[model samples]
Target chain A: MADTMISEQVLAPIVENRAVAPDHVELIISSAVLSQAEPGQFAHILTPGMLRRPVSFSRIDQENGQVGLMFQIVGDGTRWLAERRHGEVLDILGPLGHGFAAPDPTKPWCLVGGGVGVPPLYAAAARYLHRSRPDVIIGARTADWVLMAQDFKDLGLDVTVATDDGTAGHAGTVMGPLETWLQDHPDGQVFACGPTPMLAAVSAACEGRATAYVALEQRMGCGIGACLACVVKAHGKEHAEYRRVCTEGPVFAAKELIW
Target chain B: MVIDVSVSLPRGLTLKNPVIAASGTFGFGPEYSRYVDIGALGGVSVKGVSPEPWLGNPTPRVWETPLGLLNSIGLQNPGMDVFLQEDLPFLRDQNAVVIVNIIGHTVDEYAQVAARMNHEPGVAALEVNISCPNIKEGGMSFGQDPDQAYAVMKAVRQVTDLPVMVKLSPNVTYPGLIAQAVEAAGADMISAINTLVGLAIDIKHRRPALGGVTGGLSGPAIKPVALRVVYEVAQSVNIPIIGMGGIATATDVLEFLLAGAQAVMVGTVTFQYPKRMNEIIEALPQVLHEYGFASVRDAVGQALPGRAPIRGGGQ
Candidate 1:
């Protein structure tokens, strides 16, 4: 099963690196090998530290051979990545992991993202744009924390904003907007990427109402699945088994997840 | 002149080079096949496989430290059946020198895996991993005690005529005692040292960073300790030693060889650069020449006390 997904390790030069939002940097790197990356897949980037930081593809430009990665500076690794300048070469291994499966054209779809998780959903929205306009709900802690709402709007996606502080669109968590979307479109398919609690909430809301898919984040090593570092609980025939997030999925159907 | 890097262990196990992919770091084989030529490696000590499918640990199995990686993956594997059916054929096809690293929760379980792998056509050797720090039972426990370590090696030796290398744990007070015990119990060779037990705190969560709490630390942080263990164990036992712990370059490999290791396994460094082992192998000859060594064999045990004087003035 592992024979099919072939990934390349390339040295990509940063084409553009800038702060896209508060405490968030968007890094666009030019690599012919990684430019073929799909939505929801990620690049395992080498940092100054020991381990590689796994960042999802925020934007994939197949035509120009560029892939953009947007990440919040939560740790030393991301901080090092943020410090990289345009023209600086970064060692990148990608387009890794099983990405979000293409939505059925006949079904309505909604792309829900929270904070740093918004980037991959943006990539998903871009991929699904040719088929149909998906409803995109962008959520964050506050107005300053919200990301890529305008970019979704630029893509002509039906965008909704939610913040915990009520400093932006809808008040409360993304659950408010997500619940309303599920109620309005019972048959809609939901695709989300966010913190564990947010993803759990999204998965619970979609239960028996819509088919949901989620992208998971975990501390990883050897992003190629050799180290067995990034695994998530999965339902099995007898009991719960661990699945490699770097291989079986960074994206999985909500039903397959134990959470 | 071509530098000879080949290694020959007891029971007819021969490697074309001294750089092997350590167990747990490299999965069965296919995980890094996309980036690495499987046949080009000296050998691959595949992830530890038990008799039955093991569930391993819960979420947050790994944490990064300064120049090290802490992992409590708990030896999760698809078991011997899945390995023979799914993983082995791929390695066999690649013509890889396959060293099956076997582990179990009990002495019987260890014997069970050994007996099953005894007849495998493409297997080059069996690396008995009694030193995995992650598992709750039968891992570090077996390697920490001399009697238990002797029993496990003896049981494995009884089950298979295959070349058996018992992996030693560095967490023990005296790793050389366990090494000597295994050698006495009929171990063909030894691989030292397993990851050192370490911990990381998730200050944000106010708890352990890894799900398994304490994890085995590997990478550059543990190299000095590994070198110390290999140097100590080399003085205690006559069996060939396969040394591993944060080996990243050809220079590191030479350090292991000079410290009395017959071969070396590259683990966590592969996580940083998947092609590192191959690169190390390619660079070994020039590195050996620069260090004034005629061959990898000549370099072994040069740093040991009372060994012959440093040759070629390359130190």
Candidate 2:
């Protein structure tokens, strides 16, 4: 099946570029594609290199036709993205993959994000604005690495920060505080995105208590389903079924993941 | 005056244009139709089909090289049953020729898939995938050995009435031998070369970049190698050839045609720009006009060294 909008690939101009974290830069691209993007959807950004780099959305503004991309300077691709000035056009094939299913409003929602993974959760948190504020837990290496804490607080969500080196809020991984938070709100659902290890721990913690949807990151080829480059194994009823993270989902139920 | 761009193979199959979407790059079908008119291209070679659904390689299946791409997709597909039931119906509606690229681990598996295709309505040809480098069995193994390639091609040729084209791998030392063997085994056409076996290391991680250890290399890096093989096989065989490797533009297509390929297949490039194949198809007429050829068919093997190479004539 065709997994993406064929005409959604756009050449959007960068309207804003600023450092949101020590190693991360936030890009505000003016594109109509933003209006169609849901929480956890990503864009295949063409850099000054061979393949397009997939980056998830950190924020979306429909009225202004702009979407935010927060990327760390991991390799040549992200470094190229960080260097671009305003008005430069970026070839983005996006708003792709099945995004997060909206959480039930009656039940409380808990959002867990680690390091660069914190961005996509912002958009997910925004969905809870008029209903009820969701509790957000963010993990980083240090105070300088922690991102968008104030932004989540601005949205009226309770923000808990965890740093490995203890330069900020809680002096450990976000899992510790997240576990305690889950205990207080037993009926809450959890949505998370972060390092594989962090996500795995969260998935393990939320096992039978609450349903969790985890956004995965993988090296991708065609941001569409045509290429099977971004496949991950499913642990559902079928023992060894492969699912494309770029097409079927970037966000999948934690129970479905084989990892 | 309108130029005749259509290409008719020595086999009964004929394509609307000389540009076909290579297998593995284009999905089952309908994946690219939303972006471009699928009927505009000469043909669409659907992804490699197997007897059963393949899960494919692990994560990190693709990596980007300079102007090339390395992938170990492992021929992930929905299998013959689902393909015949779900995928083929949509391809039947397209205006282009459909070349089903069939893959199997054994000779019997290959023949079974081919026999099943004989009942399918839309398929114009069967591209026997004996040269894929990603999968552990049956692909490159059959392609590298002339005897194995002959056996597989002969088996499928006997089971199906469709034109059988053996897709050869470049990993072997003597591709001409393999091509000759397949031709003798009733292969109506040849597609050379498949991706070259390659590996890329991540020095920091101290491991291979691809999860499958080594992958098949494609893109501009393999273009010259593909052209040389096509030139060599064109002179040594009686059947037509489909040349492909790192083909990106109309000039590349012209080069393949002049090097003795009757038609060309475009892959890897489709990933970087989804609609690029359409651009190349549209530009072919202008390109053929520049070279003083009235039709794309007229340009085939024009650059060969022989004053008069055999047309349908035997070598």
Candidate 3:
């Protein structure tokens, strides 16, 4: 049934834009439709002359019905998007892929993030904070690479920061802190979004002890399921038995995902 | 007051707008809804459905080549059974007309899928996909042989009285003949053209760019050829035509209309921008009005060059 009508004016302008880290920037948009989008969701914002690039919704302004898209200048699309002015219209198509999932409000949890993967965690942090502030751990190569430290702290949760360069809190990667926390806090569920290496490390560090969910990013087309361009492997299933990040999830339980 | 520039599609279906999401590009419809409401389009052509589930070709199914890309997805779809059980119910919930694209190896197989599809709850039309030759013994593509295409079309026509749109492949030598054959076999409309058969070899891998040795080239490159095919067929037939090929902008949509296509479908562009169909639809009226036409239908193939082309007011 084609012909579901909508008001024109999508791809609206972002009213505010600012840098959160040296390489990371945030664009606050007038996208009420996108803001209310679930925590595990992401957007595929159009870049100049390149394929639309998917970015995670870092945070939301529920009162103003706006969304915060956080990203680093990873490629041509992002670098160009970074050069855009505050009021310029961005041909955005989101919230595109799946987002993070929250656990039972009563259940304690561990929140972990790596690199550009930190944004969606903030959204999950916001959701979890209202319920029960989960213990958070962030892993980055150096203190300069860590993102949104204050935002998570402002959420009033117990936070653990680790950097490979040992410039900040701990003297090792967040995986080291995460390992210690899982041993000490065994009952807590884990919600993690980060680099695959970090996710793999955290998944291994907490294996068989507690249930964990990890967010995945894949090269996508259509940001819908049409292209069949994006897929990740699964355990105990045929190589044919794959799931779409756009449709099924960008987030999956640790066991359901193979990598 | 917006005058609802949509058409009834002449296939017993009403379009909220004139922009239909082309097949093999929009997936099963429910997936893109999170970003843009797909139900807002004129219609949705679900991914290519087959008699059996297909795993599709290997990775590197696509490669972005400038404004467009090359894809050899090979119609990856959960068999019609799975689609009916797993995908259809969700589609029905969207409250938009769902057009199931049927691909089969033989005439009987085409008829079988079309007949079975006709019984589905939300299915509004049957679009016979005969161009998907990348797979084995599937799709009505044998119909590219004129008589073969006619056999498949006639077989499906016998079983299902629902409106059937024959999607013609550009690879066929004489698309106009195939169009005429389908029309004679009782096709209500025609959608041309499917991607042009092509290949891009990766020098490093020492193999073809697409996992499948060849891919169907869609996007701006084939649009002119698509327009010509539509223009020729429009003058040659009495049935309405659905023109498509690398349609991304309003001007592209207008060109299809001026070439005598009653409607237009936007495909590959959805990958880059899923909501592009909406933009084209929103931009269409202005494109039409800009040329001083009161309605979009007036712009249909009206821009044909003065070659004293064939006439078909046989209605």
Clash number for each model: 0, 1, 16
Q: Give the Cα lDDT of each candidate.
A: 0.90, 0.87, 0.76
Ranking 2 against 3 by TM-score, winner: 2
Best candidate per TM-score, number? 1
For model 2, residues B1-315, the per-residue Cα lDDT tens digits are 577788877556878788899998889767666565788888999999988888888868998887788999999999999998999888888766899999999998999899999958898899999999998988889999999999999999899988888899999888889999999999989998899999999887899999999999999989999999999888888888999999999999999989999889999888778788889988989998988889877888888896554363122
Model 1 chain B weakest lDDT span, ten residues long: B306-315
lDDT comparing candidate 2 with the true structure: 0.87
lDDT of 1: 0.90
DockQ of candidate 3 (2 decimals): 0.29
Tens digits of per-residue lDDT, candidate 2, A66-160, equal: 99999999888899999998999998888788778778888888999999999899988885467656889999999999999999988877899
| Model 3: per-residue Cα lDDT over A188-215, one tens digit each | 6888888777788777776788788888
Query: Lowest lDDT 10-mer window, candidate 2 chain B?
Result: B306-315
Which whole-number lDDT from 0 to 100 does residue A136 have in model 2?
91
lDDT of 1 at B194: 94
Lowest lDDT 10-residue stretch of candidate 3 chain A:
A1-10
- lDDT score of residue A188 within candidate 1: 89
Better of 1 and 3 by lDDT: 1
lDDT of 3 by residue, B204-315 (tens): 7698877777777788878888988998888777787888987899888878878887778888877666667778877877777777777766677677777432232213
